[model samples]
Target: MKDLLIKNGDLVFTGTDFRLVKGSEQLRQNVESILKTSEGEYVLDEDLGLNRENILGKGFDEELARTDIVEAIGQEQRIEEVSQIDFEKNGRELKINLKMIEMDEEELELEVDLDA
Candidate 1:
């Protein structure tokens, strides 16, 4: 798959055109988008993203958050399985680091940050 690259929630422009990404980069970006978006935010796919209430609130359950992460990513067809997943929180910021193994054995290392 190919897509216009987005950085910091904005489309990337290079001179008179936009930056593009494909293959692993595209996959990485897609996953990042999934992780960053709050569930129910996208109208067409109301269940497409992570549930922020689970991972970002006062009574946060790590396991439930993990389940939310897995379930959301499962909707993505390109991923075979997630090998490793970790979460670190500092104050109101959450950092998610994961290693995904694709169907063709291509390994992807993705890190996503969200304000908790």
Candidate 2:
């Protein structure tokens, strides 16, 4: 599958040409989407996002955040297993390290940041 490339939540293009994402790039895009979207944000796909209910309150729960990430990503059929997840919080910033195996048996590692 090919899609218009997106970076930092914006479309990426070169001059008059639009950049495209494919293969592993597409998988990375999918993973980003899964992490960035909050539950109930997409009207048609209500269950198609990460649940941030626990992270929204005053106190941050690392366990809840990890569980939410695992559960949300597990919903994607392309992801076979979430092997490892590490969370680090500093002030309002949250960093996540994720290791997973795709349905094709390919290993993937991703690091993401979120504002808490």
| Cα RMSDs, all models | 1.0, 1.3
Q: In model 2, which regions exceed 4 Å deviation?
A: none
lDDT of 2: 0.84
Per-residue lDDT of candidate 1, residues 8-104 (tens digit)? 9999999989999999999999999998888999999998888887888777777888888888788778999988889898888889999998878
Clashing pairs in model 1, backbone N/Cα/C closer than 3 A: none
lDDT of 1: 0.88
Model 2, residue pairs in steric clash:
none
- Candidates in order, TM-scores: namely 0.95, 0.91
Error of 2 at 9 (Å): 0.3
Q: Relative to the unseen true structure, what is the C-alpha lDDT of residue 22 in candidate 1, on a scale of 0 to 100?
A: 96
